[model samples]
Target: MSQMGPPRPGASMPAEKAKDFKGTFRRLVSYLKPRRKKLAAVFIVAILSTVFAIVGPKIMGMAITELFEGAYGQLQGVPGGGIDFGVIGQILAVLAGLYVFSSLFSYIQQYMMSTVAQDTVYDMRQDVNKKLEKLPLEYFDGRPNGETLSRMTNDIDTIGSTLQQSLTQFITSIVTLVGILVMMLTISPLLTLIAVVSLPLSLFVIGPILKRSQKYFSSQQKNLGRLNGHVEEMYTGHQVVKAFGHEAKSNEQFDAVNAELYDAGRKAQFISGIIMPMMSLIGNLSYVLISIVGGVLVIQRAISIGDIQAFITYSKQFTQPITQTANIANIIQSTVAAAERVFELLDEQEEVEAVTTSVLARAKGAVAFEDVDFGYGDNLLIEGLNIDVEPGQTVAIVGPTGAGKTTLINLLMRFYELKGGRITIDALDSREMSRHELRHNFGMVLQDTWLFNGTIRDNISYGKTGASEEEIVAAAQAAHADHFIRTLPDGYDTVLNQEVSNISQGQKQLVTIARAILADPPMMILDEATSSVDTRTEILIQQAMNRLMAGRTSFVIAHRLSTIKHADLILVMDQGQVIEQGTHEQLLDKDGFYADLYRSQFSAKVAI
Candidate 1:
């Protein structure tokens, strides 16, 4: 459905390092600004949850100490010495209540954060969609459609998932780290120091891995977009590949891109994947050191048995959040990479805003181009070109490829702004009107037909919203599509598949012609509209177009010279300039470029 262009130079190069990671991250965080109240509530709930969970170990250690002391006293034959069931039961109940409240608060925070995360991404997607709409057609023309689609689908999905899952976890990890550290210090500063010793070591091991993996993560995303683009392009044009026997070549290209994607993905995962194990190794070493030191302190009676037990638990708890934070840091790195891509799209130059200074209630269909200069890039394709078409006249543009026929239509429709001069409809400068208003007065039927997945009737009615069923049928009849449609099982109600392959090529062309007829605009553009049909169908379509063009200014771009022999005027164009302009017969009589082209076509037919 989309035209594929050559990949831009260096498209396959490894993605560049993120120029401003902090800036991108700040922009990403700004999305949460709108939900500040919800975020505040989530933070409060997270703090409460961490606080409750942090105190559980200390309270449980009290129960353990009571049992240990009682048993020891009994072994020493002390009077009235045994486990205190009543006190231990009360302590156990309090511990259970703390855990229950902690879990409840955790659930509350998760639910609130989930809503905040979803809403943030929803706004991001909306903004991206609007940004795309405002972007110039040149943007789409310069890149593969799948690359853009990837930003909308794959890249945004990555952001959404990270916000939903990782964001809350990041918050909880921070709170837990702080709360557990405080609790450990209360028990013993010595043990707290031992536990925190792993923090810097974890950072040391993680920093280089993150730094090295950042580029790979960026490369992985870039190559993934390229891979998607290749697949979409190949899939849509699979029939062309088969027709031209380029299956092997297509496979080679796909395999090469797939291999690149695999390489980038593997390296990214491998590099970032090292963080967790390293953190765990350092954490386990810290745990071993804390245990040995804790036993010596217990022997010296420098710390109570309950305090030592709680301190060890806090030591384990301390390292866990550090490990989690490290892992999240890697995830955030990847997410920021995705955000950078999306931001790149959002930052693309948009079409100039429409400055509407004039409005046409109904155009008279008199179109003119004066001193026009335009091009896709810096080099002009049409320079100082001019043309005039009167109301109710059909102007035929005949040219070789790259002769600027389509460029003329693009300028007329205001798809691209002119570099010099002006084009006017009924003497109204096109730039003075909004694009929607300018395009509303013209109907176009191109050689490559477009029909979305819908019933045939719906496709025809797309030209004019709210078109009556009878009007749709009338338009179809005028285009000579009614008969073939009725022959189908569902007739007008027959649903077109995604590719619209259920209908013949001729039928598809007829359907597009019907759509144009239904539009009934003041002007029409037919670009080789009958090129896909058989001779009989072409003749029928030409007749329908003749009726459709009555009393409307029409521009027809044709390659077959015979098709435009009777036009009111013929402009023979070459190298972005009109070489000859006259009635078809008058040009035939001139024995010039037009005459030579006509005779060559005639001779070829006769030879065949």
Candidate 2:
């Protein structure tokens, strides 16, 4: 199989490698530790089943030998020695019993294993979910949603499937191999040697194929993740693609990723596909050699023909397990790779621990950023930035794109840790409080209005769980969303689909505003909350925002200059520096950068 070269830029998921297999396997086994008793039961039952199953060939051999000897004696003129019907019946009955018991034990083993597998994966997924909640926002910020989704879904699913399928098969294959090898040895050691000798040849044929297939399988999984990410990202932004006439380029990129996935998948499948045939070929050669040697031994009276038959059956059984084990070996490689991906996410650095200090109960909404220096990675975007806000003051931040306006907001919320400095609320550093408590103090309405698949009432109440229906209605009324909610087909009970495209963008913004209003936090952060609305809707949103912002410290990242004209303090930012700061009129009177920007908006309005 050909290895894939460097991936296309942004058209790939993080390339997955088979790393720390032993450690991952060890951790994986730890999931089974709690269910050790059940696993032990499964192990014992599998062994008993294989033992029972292996006894059949030897028993059948004895029955065949008895019949053969009886017939031979009759041919030599013994009158009543033609056949032993009673003995044959007994042997058949015992064989049936062995088979029945074997099947029963096998069934029980499978049931136990299924329970163990499901339980282990259930615990694993729960741990991963908990880990996700504790991870810093930057962890997600630096990766694509699809990559995260892949680990949570696809990689975990791989672990689940391998557990459910491969784990039991692996145990069964090993047990069967040992059982058959023992049975063959009892029947004829020479024939067993022939069978055992073929083992090395099988390995010689399979080892290289497996070693090569692993890389392709790893590549295949990665490409699959990338393809899923591309599809998800493209579909999520489909409207943008169509609006900007970028569908051709999008399709071209999708094709490139899809082709990579196909290449890796085909190579992996093709390599794994060769294992069974090659093993069968080796088994066949061994069988011929065993048959010739057993025939010669039977003529020499060293072994019965029935023993030869039994040996042949054992050889077939032996090779079957070997083939299955080899396939399972390949599957384990993929499973390990998947487990590594899941464990990597589970091992991500969590948010910084809250320090022990006085908790800020009933926050006064006064916030301060003191000597705050921070960066996204190594790029120092915000340096020595300091700001202080009084209770119930509206601070409007205006900045060009990438001017660190939102980054500042992110720091204020502790979504990203400060490189050096402190963010304090009510004179207490935010790090002193639990993240949940710290975040609970602020209600945010971002430019992107995200509404899940739920009712209008549910979306509104998302900010305040257990909020009564009446409270939901009140919040909607305050956000000027109540009338529209009532006008909808199902009113508050309307179910939203995954896309949430059922409502207009302005309506979605209203829903989010209703959510924020319901939260009723001490502080509010509105980042262009009205950017998605039309002029009329913007007027309504602005009015609702004014009501929501009442008696709360608010940080408004304003895009439209007119919205912030009445703000208590307007901050003008350029290239990550505070270029100007004062009341709107005061800043405008200075005739500086603020004035030029404020004038440009009106000039554009006049031109229009």
Candidate 3:
């Protein structure tokens, strides 16, 4: 149950918190490479907008000085001269021009960054899905459906938003902040000195807040994943919960995690909220310090009034950028946390990819397991085994619970690699062949039936993607599913939303069987294929399966010993190994595990 993630970095707050912020910022910008030209446009626009923003205030200060010095007339001849409407018009025109550029560039930056973010996320999703298909069954065995889905949906969305918005904002803010600093120092180092003195204090307050926020933010997401997993469990097992009268227990478990998530979310958000207000308060206080001192210097006539006005404007300018810097730090931290999780899936070692490909090589349905040893991870499910099934033979594998029945099928399909030994189809090793080539030879019907949200015909034809309508109907008839399928609203075209939930369980199994039958693989695996159906339906499906196994090598894993009485080779497995092998009557006479299981299960059914 342990997560196989790398050691988490720098959760504990370092003494130099700003240093950590800078490091995280640098690392986050590394993913913007593939669209460098588009991003470069964003960068140029961001710089221009920030420059104009700083220039706007400087222009206002210049306007005030122009009125005082009689270059532009003063309002109502109040200070030095009459107002010059002509020059005022020019200033306003330039200001409007700069506003136009800023607005237009804002749109461009957002459009470009959003495009990059979405495209990169699209690529990530496809790659992760491909990786999931490549990973061995063991990886999925330890996880629940909801958690895996949470990783795919909620987690991916979080990563996408962070990459799209946070990356753009943080980058723009940095460029803006640098411009403000340079302007502030150029206007007056003395006032800029007093304004920037608050930097150490802003860091002092926000450092701990960032660290605490990061921890709680991470915990909140983990709790979200758990809550999602719990919800999925409840939904899938709703019948069990209601039947056992354990709904109260389930509710209590859900409430406990819900409460934890609420607390963690509030704590993280509260810390983030406190940061902005504190930064504002520090900025205003710094603004006041610079304004008061600069006013005194202007009154003493040591500095020009115009210089003092620009100095005051730049003081607040510098302080506003400082506040912007704090939000940038927070943004980067949250994004890194999200990316860390996303990258985990991106970097997982794909289930050993095959070195050879032979898709056109038709298997002769000769399957041999030579000295195979395997397990779900380290649990040791199967050990050093040997079995051979020639073409056109029906092999039945019978076993008790946890006896590795389905495990054998997984090995043959290359869903899990053999820990030791080789599986060969017509002399070529399974590992040497591409998984698509190896699995192409199989038509499998699992005990747990799964029907996607599609029409009955669509479900059946899923295996054979390009099958004609005649072929689909033919496969359905062979599986005894076409009769009921015809009763639906649109018949073969009737869409089954949220799975084929309206159909009976036996019908669902039949439809699944039809899907496999449509593929018409050279080998088939029926793993307790009829375990869910009624006696009458069981017989019908059994008849269909007999036809399926006629010319193909087939293996049936079942607990119903009666079903496999006529198997060409019957394997009775125990504790992950074959304890006995023979047909039904042959095993009944062995007086071994097979006989005892047959006596317990078959005798009761026959007596009934």
Candidate 4:
């Protein structure tokens, strides 16, 4: 199949081309370290197979020599002058045995090599997956999902294929080259020298092509990842594209990336393609050289006609490996390039280790952010920010975009590390607690409700593993979702498609609320949970949320001022700092930033 186009943002393109070809080659080979036993066995079998094959040409030469001697004796009217059928039969039988052994050994070698290659790839894939899990969200935030996926699939697959095919070919080619050289020398050193002379010329033709092709192959893999990223992004946001009338723009961008990919692929293939015919041309030239030289040796009686025939066969065998080695060299370059990409992912910085044994049992929902300072990177968004919330207090945070509203929740849940100060739950430092235990204390319902392709019951119960049916239905009822769910054709048993388009957005939001309700944590975060629903559905959801938040500490991030009007505390924020905090009446009485925002929204609603 053809490779993909220009890279996706944050896709697994090489950060830089691998400058150390030998180092990358060594690291790629090291993946086989764990399978050394199988590899060693494969090597031994390969050697045995090559040895068996090498004996055939020499034996046939001997058989021909025997026939020539017998015929000459028969012409002299001497004893044993006629064809020696017995000797010929013995030689033929040995040849058949050699051929059979060679085939058997070759099969065994291939089986073992295949086992080693697949097992190594399995280990690599496992390590990459585990590494992904351990890596911090920051690493992912900087990269495209499709790029990482391409590395996981396309790059690893390339390594596996190269190992399966090229590895065996490489070993066989080397052994065949050496063996043929030895056999040719035994027949005639002069002919062997002629065969040896072609090796440098073959390298001369291959070296520059291999060097030039490496960069293009690397580019091809990068472009493939880029192409995958584009497709994934366009398809994932296809609705947005249509709404914005961006289909033509999307196609134009895709074509641009596709054209670059095609160019890279063409250049890579074209450069590498030169190796085969060039090698073949050199091989043919070597064959002709050996033939002429061997014929002279035969005419001079320095070597028998049988030896000349064997030497010519050995010459072809020698050149064949040289050609194969050139091809394998190109494959190795590609494999090494792919290996570098995989290793780059494997080498990414992982999240800071957490205290695995720390547990927060029955958290009372008291949250404190004491002199907390934070930033996405170096911008220093939140500096010396302090907040204290009593258990069961509803804190509604209102801010323009990029005001670090969500960053507060991210820090509370330990999704991102705090740069300064501490966050405490109850009386204990959150950093001292395990992330799982800390996060378990809080339940979140995001604006974009995510529902998996499963039954409604399954999606709701996902929040609490092993939740009983009774608990699921109770949570759904509390979220006011049970009635709507039961109205469906299959009720709670209704299976949602991947997009969950079968249900209305309000219903989807309700299901996510039900999931959070099922978790029933002491602390909750509602990020614009009711923003997208119609007025009637919003009322129903608000009632459900009010009940859900009655005695729990809640953090509500709402753009609509009306939903948070009854909050115990409203934090009005801008540019990562809280500009005002109070109830709706107090904020309006102050006629500050919060009042302005509320008035603006109220006026917009009035205009509507």
Candidate 5:
């Protein structure tokens, strides 16, 4: 489906797609409620069309009955008639007219149903994406991007397709089926009873198969997610895989996944497919028995020819809805599976909602963390950590790797819920205020610059919606990205595909920095912001950072000690604690852990 070759060629589909469907179906129904008007319209059209279909057959049977009665002299001929031309013409005309009306409503029915289905999908995708945006950074840890994307795209699409077909068609078939049954019961209850007797048998036979199919269908969705995740991992790390000559291993893994998916698909298909044919054969046999009884009754003069004709038509109609429903077992399972995945995401509790507050005064740029603690789960990354970046000051956080520098920054930005302590802008606690209100006042440039496939202008102006040309350019200039951007052929309007291999890594970092600068927040956070740049670019970024930090609270984290040498205050961290806090000169005087780290770094540089 992803053009990634088949699913991982050897991995098996899981047995449980999820725990249960009750919660999922309930949530899914909520989305449908908003568009109920359209659903009602579809139902109306389907009912009308079914009525017309029944009328067409009834008219034919009536015409035959009229002729038979006239020939047998049971009824006097109309004005000039053996089945009068005018009467026949009227019936035929009404039947034709009803059919035309039916076709018109059918068209309307399909169009409205499709619109409802697709629009619901569109709304669902938007909602999921919005939820993801609000979710904390921890939500994505170890979660496969491929699996998430599949749920948003393929899984959502499956629900849309099911809505388009099953919802409207099933309604139509059911109404038609019921109308036929009523007509048959009116004409001959005995025959109608016989025809539908086999119907219950269908449900009984399909019940267990449906259960198993449901189980397999759920597993199929999950396996598909895993397969996508594996393929995405392989694709993203293609260079490493090739460099390590692991193609054979990759192929073997993929083959195993693919084989499992193939087996699952085949099995689910067979299980669901068997029910419909079995149902149809049983229904047909019932119809044959009913027909034989009806014919015998007609021959014995116990039932009229017209009545028998209508009964046969009713018999076909009686079992048709059941047949159609049975046939859709596979599709229904697919829908349920997809719905389960989508609902799972929808059900994940969103982090604290950011309330909207009145616009505040421009930031005076004071940030403080008083006794903060945080971690992904049971493990604590930072405990009782306290720090401050005064207005117009640059403060740096330095530590051994995984000393929670990034985790700290994430907490300050409200990317994760702080387990303990308070982070404040100026003097107000971040939790007491709205996230939007607080975050709108700071700019953060991440270490990994996420670039969208758009013109360079789009990426830079991403957060600053409705930004003007001069504003974007000015920000770029301040970040030192203007020079490189001008070097590009299209300047501001150059289209950048994901294949931005031609650009240097430092250039992209500068571009991201420019985006943050353009945002013009009262404060800024730069975490290992210059980790990958050359000495020259690092200096340039540092200079731009210095300018950006002017009159603003700034927090910087860098592994290389040389870059953060000018920080107003240095916070030395070790194992989730602030072991030391001072200016660079003050720390140098202590001659402790920071000094030792500095020495080790220089020694390593010399060895290299």
Candidate 6:
């Protein structure tokens, strides 16, 4: 078991700044293209809602002016002097109607925008999922599981929430700003000028805060992803950590990541949080100036008192949108950062799509590797490797660790593309056949058994879709797992937990063997499939595998030399090339590498 190690230096450092903000933001907006109609509705409805709400203060001012004039006439004992409550009632009715329509349209806009947001993200998630499926295996091999998961879940979620909430707020804030500005200018340009002065001050305050907070926002997102990755890794491997007594070390690493996240998040929130209060203070100062000027205009009979009342209201409303737009800018900045991460995943190099000029419905299982050259990166792991297998031959590959045994299987199954030469199945080029067609012809049982959280029957039936109860039971019996499976409380219906720890290791191997048996493909690949069982269970599994491999082209990667003594052809591999190839007796008679390895293992067993 491998123990968890400390995080690499600078692992918690803020991610590099977004490289293409405009490009990434534009791409993010493209998801909305499909829902442009709905988005258009949202935009128009937002404008209408703001328009109605914007007219409210002006209309209410009329009522105030009517009451003021009426009260003054009554004080002068003029005829028909009393305040006209009837006219005020009519004004209130119209005002109520405006508010009602404003709220209704606001709700409509919210509903429409939410759907658009959800639909856009739905398409984005679908695209990300499809891209993941098309990406080459090397992408996964080079990245951490948790890091990839954070991109899929956390990063996408950030995009979703920003779309749902911030996008609509952004639309409404702009419209509110424009509408309130128009309403204020109609009342008095001088007071409007006083109100507009606050705009520059507000911007001055917000500029530095935004610039300072933007990096922290980016850092906050990056550190959050790192923290998620760390937590996921530690939680999943907690058993190993405990067994290795690395709890203290794991905690130390966690603390380091957590501390970094806290620092970034605190700075980001604190800086962005200053925008609102600063905007309010500036708005208050502008309000004082607007009031003094408006009061002077009203005293000079240059403007109605009611108009001054309405101008004050408009000034407050004007500054609000500016504040909101600043906050939304911060939010959009963070959203774009998240979108860039998702786009990076989407832009990964995909596996070369297979062009099927020849379709093999049922292969004869004659697999051949001719002059094959391949490597993970630059250094060739296997060069000029040639191998041929006739139908119905059991070929066992024996090699030390890193001897290219698994790489051979990976190439055969088309998991990785060959670098120099081509592989053939039934005399047809593997590349000419679709990967789906090529991989479907083989069933594999690896050292690490994979079983999902489902019933035993479902897991077994996974090897062959729609496998009947009889077929599943027969396959289990063939693998020698049926007897033990029946002893459990739920028998075939027993659900495997997520970890599949309900059963012993040997039992898990047996279940996997049953799954392969049910598959019954034309060829089989077994990678130390029986290595996890006891002696008796190993013998049972070997017998089951022998039966499974009969009359089928099977490749077995065996570490224990004794297991492949009966194989028709045994290839002894070292350093990515086969050094010897013959039957067990022939190799022993030659007294080559195979003989030395066999003797060593036999001697070790005897000593034990």
True-structure RMSD, every candidate: 2.2, 4.1, 4.8, 4.3, 5.1, 2.7
Alpha-carbon TM-score of each model against the true structure: 0.95, 0.95, 0.89, 0.92, 0.87, 0.94
Which run of 10 residues does model 1 get worst, by summed lDDT? Answer: 1-10
- Looking at candidate 4, what is the lDDT of residue 313? 82
Model 3 agreement with the true structure over 349-372: per-residue lDDT tens digits? 677775685443678888898999
Q: What TM-score would candidate 1 get against the native?
A: 0.95
**Clashes per candidate, residues 3 or more apart or on different chains:** 0, 0, 3, 6, 14, 0
Window of ten residues with lowest summed lDDT in model 6: 1-10
**Which residue runs does candidate 1 get wrong by more than 4 Å?**
1-14
Task: List candidate 3 stretches off by more than 4 Å.
Answer: 1-30, 67-80, 302-310, 357-360, 377-379, 606-608
- What's the distance in Å from true for residue 505, model 5? 2.0
lDDT of 1 by residue, 385-428 (tens): 88999998999998777777877787888878899999999999
> Any residue pairs clashing in model 2, and if so which?
none
lDDT of 4 by residue, 1-608 (tens): 01112232433343356666888888888888888888888889999999999989999988888888789889999975888979988998999999999999999998888888899899999999999988876677666777889999999999999999889999999999888888887888777888899999888878888888888888888888888878888899999999999999999878887887899889989998888888888889888988887778777888987788878788878888888888888888788888888888998987676665446897898889999988866667789888888899999999787777887887888878888999989968998887778888889999889999999999999999999999999999999999999999999999999878999999999999999999999999998888788999999889989988989999999998899889999988787688899899999999999988888988998899
lDDT of 2 at 523: 95
Candidate 5: lDDT of 561?
89
Error of 5 at 7 (Å): 25
Candidate 6 residue-wise lDDT, 423-509, digit = tens: 999999999988888888999988888999999999999999899899999999999999999999999999999889899988888
The CA lDDT at 441 in model 5 is 85
